[model samples]
Each structure stands twice: as C-alpha cells, then as structure tokens.
Target: MDKKEDKHKVAEEPMEHTLDCMSRLETMSDEEWNEFFSDKNSMSDCSFLLGYKEAKLRKEAIKPNAEKAWQHFHTSYIVPETTRRHMGIWIYPLATIAAILAIVFILKFVHLNSSDIDVSRPFMAFTADHAPQLITITEDGSRPNIIEGRQQRDGILINDKEADFTHASFAKKMIRSIATPRGKSYKIILNDGTMVLLNAESKLIFPTSFVGKQRNVRLIGEAYFKVKHDTAHPFIVQTEKVNTRVLGTEFNLRAYPTSDTHVTLISGSVIVCNRSNNKAIKLCPGQDATLLGNKDFDITTVDTDYYVQWKDGYFYFDDLPLVEVMKELGRWYNVDIEICDNSLLSYRLHFIAERQASIDQVVENLNGFSYLSATRQGQKIIISKKMHLKSD
Candidate 1:
C-alpha cells in the first residue's frame, strides 16, 4: 500500500480498537471484567485505544451504564496486584477509570450547557493556601525571639515559650504582637491560658507572660476570645477606640482600621468602654455594641453566631448588606472589591459558606440568589448588576 493509504489505515486502527473494546465491555460479565482488568498489558492497551478523540465518542451521549460500570470498576476491580510484574494492573485501572469518568463529566457538561450556568459570576477555579501568620513586632520595640506553628487537628497550633515570671528579667514586662495578613487566620493560647482566635488582617499584642495585677492586651483587628477567668486580675482587650474588660467570658471583637469597632458577647458579661470618653457599656450574651467612627456607642441585640462564625471557618451572612459582605470577602480572599453602583450596597444577602471556598464559588452562590454579577481583573473584583436579556 502507498504511504497515504497506510497512514489512513493506521489512523483507523485506534477507532476500530475503541469500538471493539466497547463491544467487549457491553457483554463483559463480572468475571470477564475482572479478568480484563487483572492483566496489566491489556489494561494499558485498552487505555491507549480508548483515547477520547480517537474513539469518536465525543459527539455521542454517554451510555446510561457508564456511571454504573465506573462505580463498580472503581470499588471492586481497582485493587493492588501483589506481583511486581502486574504492578501496571494497579495503575492502569485508575487511568481507565479516569477515562470513563471523563466521559460522564463531559456528558454533564454538555447537559448543563442548556441549563443556566451564570457566566457573569466568574469563579476563580483555583485554590490558594492561607496567608502566613507572622510576628510583626514585639514589645520593647524588637522582633519576637522565636516564632513557630504547625497544622493540627483543631487548627494551626502556635508554640509559646514559657517565661520565668518570678525572675527579675520578667519585671521589665515584654510585649509580643502577632499578626495574620489578609487571607489567613491563627489560633494562639496566651501565656495566661486564654485562647484567642485571630482572624485575617488582625493583630494581637500581649505580654510574653502575664505580670502584675491586670492581664492586658491590645487588639488591632478581629478576634474571638475565650478568656481564662482570673477574678483577681481582669483581662482587658484594648482596641483603637474602646477597651473590653472581661473576668471570664467568650466574645468576639472586631476593630478593623477602616470600619466601626464591634464587641459581640457570646456567653458571659463584659464591659466595652470607649477609650476617648471612658463611656462604658455592659453587654449581655447575644448583645453587641458597635463603636462608630465618631466614638458614639450603639448597643443592640444580635445573633452572636454571625460575628464569631469566622473562628469556625465559615462566613455566615444573615441579612448582611452587600457592601459589608464584599468587604468581608475581600479580606478573606485577599482581593479588592469595587462596587461600581452604590445601590447594590443596599441589597441584603444571607448565606453560609466555607472560608476556604474559592472566590468563584462564593460569587456563583451569590449570583444564584441575587441580581449581582462579579468580574475579576487581576486582584480586583468588580461588582455590578446582572444584565437581563429581554424575551421576544
């Protein structure tokens, strides 16, 4: 045969092989399927033969049994082969299963094309690790002596060095501050046994070890506090505009630089006092106090879950304004959100989503319930109203 004819015949071989394999699969009993998959060379040959384009199966709808076959093969036939000679048997099953899954996935993609897949709500499609938590500065205007942490079952575990409180060196009172940049969070146990969950873009400054009568710390961002009760020595969280005093209680404090400061009491009574005016307000469980930019305090009843959900690795928005929602998303995703229209800010949305979910997934969920659209350009996410198509 001539070169052109031989080339055509070679091209047709893969297609013919694919058809033959499919025909065999149609009549393959459980024992035969196992036998076919049990052989390494045959499995490899099947994989090469079933290449998507060569099979000419892209245009065909996935067979109803494809999913069932995949499930059965995945759970039963894909097992480890003891002999080294058949090691490829173990690997080839996975490749064949992946090829089968691709077909099912392609069918779903084709089916969804007719359904609504909102393009305006673009998702990031990629995942990113949480930003690193760092010790920016320490008391005495120096850096931390040592900073170390590791992932644990509960969360990231921060290591703390024990200080000799009784020694004369401790009399000097050393303060240490740890900060988590945008897109990361950390949990640290203070020297006093108080546990603090610091949210992204937040900082906590406390002594290397508690000393004297008062256990005090200054906060520059948001944190959930589980203070260790010391009746004789009160725990104080000093913010930019307010100070929260607690003997023993669970509460969440938010004091972002550009936003109003808030203290939400979860389980105990605490006093939130304004720094400038020394005006103090006692908050009960489920109560929240907001310190406005003007230093005016607004006390109201609130669901504490909405405030402390970040510690639990979720963003829980309950009738929260669109602007506020975007602000929170921007912080956790480490992106800039620009709202093109001010009216969108008035729209309220309520949803609960994992903090680690990609920005695209969040935007998709958001667009599903609201008339909003988000587009990303570099690190900025632009929000606007979704355009409606008129029906003829």
Candidate 2:
C-alpha cells in the first residue's frame, strides 16, 4: 500500500507465449544451468518474478532439458542482463537498450494496474534468505492480529528474554483453569498421547506435558477431550468449581466466566469433584454434572448426547432452562445473548447446526415454539420475545 512496497509488486505480462520457460530451461545442459543460477539473491530486484512463474503453469508442461529451463528462469527474473547484453549475444540488431527497457517497464506496469494479485505466490515466505514471513490475520468484525505458528509472540518478552515456562507432564497433580478468546483454539497432545480441543474463550493449562501419575488438564470455558488409556496414569479435567477425572474416555466441559460449569461424560468413566471439601462423584456414560459458581452442585443421568452435542455440529437441549440454553448459545454463536422476557426464560428447545452457522438461523430454529424476534445493530444481535404467526 506504500510507494516503497509498491515497487516490489510484480508487473503482469501476457500469458499467450507459445514457448514454455520451464521447457526451454529443461533442454539446457545441467552445467550451464548451474553456472547461471548459482547465486540468486537479487530476486526482489527484478519485478517479473510472478509473470515468469505464471508462464510455467504446471510441472508437466516442462518438456525441454531441465538445465535450460532453470537457466532461463534464473536469467529472466533472478539476474536479467540488459538489452545491451542481448545485442552482443547475436540478437536484436540495432534496438536501443533504453527503448527496450522502457517498453518492458510500461507493459509490466499496465498489466499490474489491470489485474488482481497473483495468489499463487506463497506470501508467507521470503526468497532472499528463505525466511518464513510473519502472517497477519484480521478477520472482519474481529481483533486485528499479527501471529505466527498459532501463538502470538509477545514482543517485549521475547526481546527481553524474560518469559519462562516449565515443561512438565500433565498427570495426577492439581491443575488450575485456563481460557482463550474468540476466533481461537488450542491443540495439546497429552503425555499419554491423548488429544484435547480447547474451544474459543476457553483455557486449560496444567503440567507442561503429563507427569506424576494421572493425566490432568484444567478446564475453563469449554473443551472436548479425548483421553489416552493408561493403567498407571488416569486423565483428569479440573474446573474452578468441579474436577473431572478419567482414564481412557471422551468428554466435554462447559464452564464460562458468566455461567456454572457443566461436565458431560460421553463414552467412558469419569469422576466430578468439588474443590472446597474434596467431595467426589463418579460418573458413567449418559451422565451430566452441573456445578454452580455459588455453592450448590448437582448431577443427573440424562441423554448425554444432549450435553455433548455442542462439541459436534448439533446443539441439543433437553428441558434446559432459558438462562442455561442462552449461555451455550452465546459461546457457539459468538454473541452476548440477552433474555428480556423472564416468563419465556423457562422454554427449552433442541437443535443442531455446524459451528459456523448464522445467528439468524439459530434464532429462527429455537424460536419455533415461541414468538421470538432478532435484529442486529452493529456487533450486537438482540433477541426479543415475539409472537410466532402462521408465517415467518
């Protein structure tokens, strides 16, 4: 977007050439090619890199000697000789070098002004030193970010070399809760080779890996975990209010900052515990544990799928209160849900959709039984109690 940056953008050229650059390079001898492309550091200087690249669309199009193709490639973009040099090479009889350069410059500039960017270029790489370039992603209506390798490098800490993290296996010991922001998730392969998916606005930080005896991962927000079976070490998920321990199993934890934590076990044995008095309750398949942030915590045996559906494409609700259902909806829909009608808060519904679904679809589906209307004013989507008529 700046003048300095604009100088580096490649000017496009017509792709109607009958001869292929790669084929021509392939026909040349390897020795000649090696001598030509030995040191190609000026790649950014010659602006035809993208144009030369498009000229060799696919690998199959290169039918000439490999060396010749490489030499042409290196020469055309890497280290091009002026037209004066071309004149000495028994070509282009009395053509002025200045005229040829001007023509090339005009053509490339005009082409670039008329076309879109060449997306084939791996924008995340630098050709000069083969460095991996930093990528910045600023999705619409979200925070702008410059992150690398999923983790944003904290500039001050990295520059000062002050940050330190101890590597420990996640087993047995007590782990505190953790959380993440929107448009973010974490992938952690446990010490026992179990995988955990920490969803957005969630956090789970325990031992560096897994150590001691049991596999433990603290949970805050929501997460879907696959525990690895080990006779010696059992896996556990700890929350601010409850603790979930298991050996080999799959389960989900929903504990947002504004709501009570819910532990739903799907396919294996688990124990949900109270942190205050160390009270423990073992759970089997089709079981659910609810821990309020206040004091009282309850457990019941219901259709576990109803609780675990959010982990999949389904958002299932079975006789759930409106406040509770609104919490779950808030997480997946990435919106702050407000309940204006206390009378309608007791209504419950069951529905399923992929995580990337529109908020309108969710509202329309859940409002099938009641009169609920929604309107978006900026980032906030307001849901109000309305009457469901014969038609939408």
lDDT of each structure? 0.68, 0.52
**TM-score (C-alpha) between model 1 and the true structure:** 0.60
**Candidate 2 lDDT, 81-110, residue by residue in tens:** 322332233232122322223334433454
Model 1 CA deviation exceeding 4 Å by range: 1-139, 143-172, 389-392
Model 2 gets an lDDT of 0.52
365: Cα error in model 2, Å = 3.4
Q: How does each model score on TM-score?
A: 0.60, 0.51
Give candidate 2 misplaced runs (Cα > 4 Å). Answer: 1-179, 183-186, 292-297, 366-370, 387-392
Clashing pairs in 1: 123-360, 139-175
In model 2, the Cα lDDT at residue 281 comes to 78
Model 2 residue 75 CA deviation in Å: 69
